[model samples]
Target chain A: MIERDVIVKGDAGVHARPAMMLVKEAMKYPCQVMLIKDDVEADCKSIMSVLGLAIVSGSRLIIRADGEGDAQAVNSIVSMIEHNFKPHEESAEKN
Target chain B: MANNRVQLKDFLGDTGIIDLQIRLVAGSTGITREIHVGDINRPGLTLAGFYDFFAYDRIQIFGLGETAYLHQLSEPEKKEVLEKFFSYDVLCCIFTHNEEPDSLFMEYADAKGVPIFITKKDTTKFTSSLVYLLNEAFAPSVTLHGTFVDVYGIGVLLMGKSGVGKSECALELVERGHRFIADDVVILKRIDESILMGSGAPMLKHHMEIRGLGIINVKDIFGIRSVRDRKRVELVVILEEWEQGKEYDRLGLEDQTHAILDIDVPSIMVPVRPGRNIPIIVETAALNQRLKKQGIFTARELDRNIRESLKRENKEE
Candidate 1:
């Protein structure tokens, strides 16, 4: 099993777009990926589960994976979170 | 997709649900054609030469009214409407109340290869039965090895391998004033693509076979309120034998699903062993599912509250 802790940096945090992008990225891997915010855990590949986490900005998220492709899936998710879910977003409003 | 098509002969003769002893009068060869629609139309307006909005895909019903209308029309006018109507690929026409079509109409039906059927049931009675049969016949379904029960108005399907005590748990739930839908085998049908409805096998309706207790009628023993004909499946509870050294969901914060017939349903796995109150757990889970439907997730809510408090503490520091 592989795990990493990263902080959400955007103002809106993991709402629809970021949650969907994370789910989409996680689905490409053949591993069971999960996101844990505080005590709440969510399946990384499920949009509903990720959205249910409601992990707002500055919240520490633990991305964990266990399976054949756990390392690759976990690395990508952690990297995405550390970058503030930025590449997919349309510029920053600097709030 | 079962919605594609079906044969006319099979629709009447094969389906035991319709219960109409209908006989074909004409267009016998068309029995092998397709029945694309899951509905039956009375063809009231279509008979009056208004083919603008004619539902040719549906099973057209020509009852006493249509039969009488044919008789009133002159031979040429009648033939024109029949020819115009039959020009389309009509699935099949049924005459209810034992009202057989006239010889002229039969000749036209035979020529067009559009099969005509006769049923003795009244229009109202036969229509309802036909609608139900068509709905059942076309509904996409799959048989599952599970026991279905209604706990607090939520359909909870208990799924597990053999000798897993699913029936015993269901029996306990029934004893706790819950309704029994099916035991041992559940036929789950997709109402649309999203909604799943489950019912027991006909021969085993309301009957559950326990390991040592043999077969028992849930309805007979528990009364009418204790058994239901069918219920909309909302949640699935999988009972597996308790396996030590395996990690289980302790927090209940993450959501899980069980896939059945391409639809993913919210599911939970409960490790079964001695001294565990499986029925109460199932009841609580069902109640939680209802609350979730009402836009409330208790665990998630608690997490949010805790996170906000911790943030406030950090701010104060």
Candidate 2:
């Protein structure tokens, strides 16, 4: 497994739309994915789970993946987060 | 490593800790000692025994019944038991049935810096809860990156450069019958040599934020089953914006890998393009990665076939 800590840079944080997007991305792998906040843990691929957290921008998150392609998965997720999840944006806006 | 501190509520239940006391026992060092009332053959003993043997970092004792008799025991008996307790490397004493330890025992415990806990629940329930807690607390764990999604019996992690729609893709995947692990950031720690465990940060616990929608709680929206604290990271899919001039791998002939700590993991780069179904692509990528792990590499197989054909032509020439 590989894990990385990332800051939620997007303006709204991980809200409904992005939560759904993240869940969709997580559904692609064959490994188990988990998101933890403090003592609370949630599934990374569920929109409801993402919503349950009510994560806001500037919150620190631990993006973690394990199994075969864990490193790549972690890297991709971290990159996407670093880029602020805006696939269409030319450059990520710093929050 | 220091043992993780458990919250008092977990051990003592919902009731607030009305009273807490620590005392140093004069004699014991390593041996475990316990005082409890009632039959020695109760069901609670089974659990108590487990704690005696497993729960503590050092010694453990299960004491039943009245504290008065124990305190009144003959000096020889007390010395013998205390000596035995002290002989070991660590010692712990448990008083069951809410039986308070004598003032002397409390003083001893305090002086020794030993942790003492008193619970109002029956021994059976307490023991059972303790067993459950111990197991959970000691379970092996690991940490990794990439949100873990369970889709069609596969664990997929959608990767990409920042703003490349990893979260969006994950949301879509969830709608398509997949589970969610985490978004934006994940925490991974190694609990054992082989296992890598993953989790989310405290503030981001059950939340995900999109570019436009703002923050959302995953647990509330998805229910208890939708969220998980940890999972093994399996596959990685890198999402990168499509560059018209840049050459992207059209075939799977070349292998790309990324390293986490000492482990080298397989990686796939998926270019982001309009009208592309990212979740589907990521799902396929996970499937492909699984197949490759099983030694079935489509790219390698094709390369071998091409090489074989070329060799056959050369022989004919």
Per-candidate DockQ values are: 0.01, 0.04
Number of the top-ranking candidate, with DockQ as the measure: 2
* TM-score of model number 1: 0.59
Candidate 1 lDDT, B1-317, residue by residue in tens: 22334677776664644577788889887878877778878788888977787888888888889888888999889878878887887878999989988888788788878888998888888888887777766888776668999999999999987568888999999999999998866878876677788987675679876766756789999999899988989999999999999888898899899887778899999999999999999999999999999999898999999999999999999
Q: Put down candidate 2 lDDT per residue, B1-317, tens digits, no spaces.
A: 11344432233323222222223333333223321221122213323222353323432434464344456667666555444433333334556666676655555555554545555555666555555444444544333334556655455556554468877887777766677777766655444454444556555675666667866666787777666665665556778899989988899888887554444456778888889998888778877877876889898899899999999999999
Question: Which runs of model 2 end up more than 4 angstroms from their true locations?
Answer: A1-95, B1-146, B219-226
* Candidate 1 Cα errors over 4 Å, as ranges: A1-95, B1-58, B61-73, B80-90, B94-133
fnat, candidate 1?
0.00
> Chain A of model 2, TM-score against the native?
0.85
lDDT of each: 0.83, 0.60
**Native contact fraction, candidates in order:** 0.00, 0.00
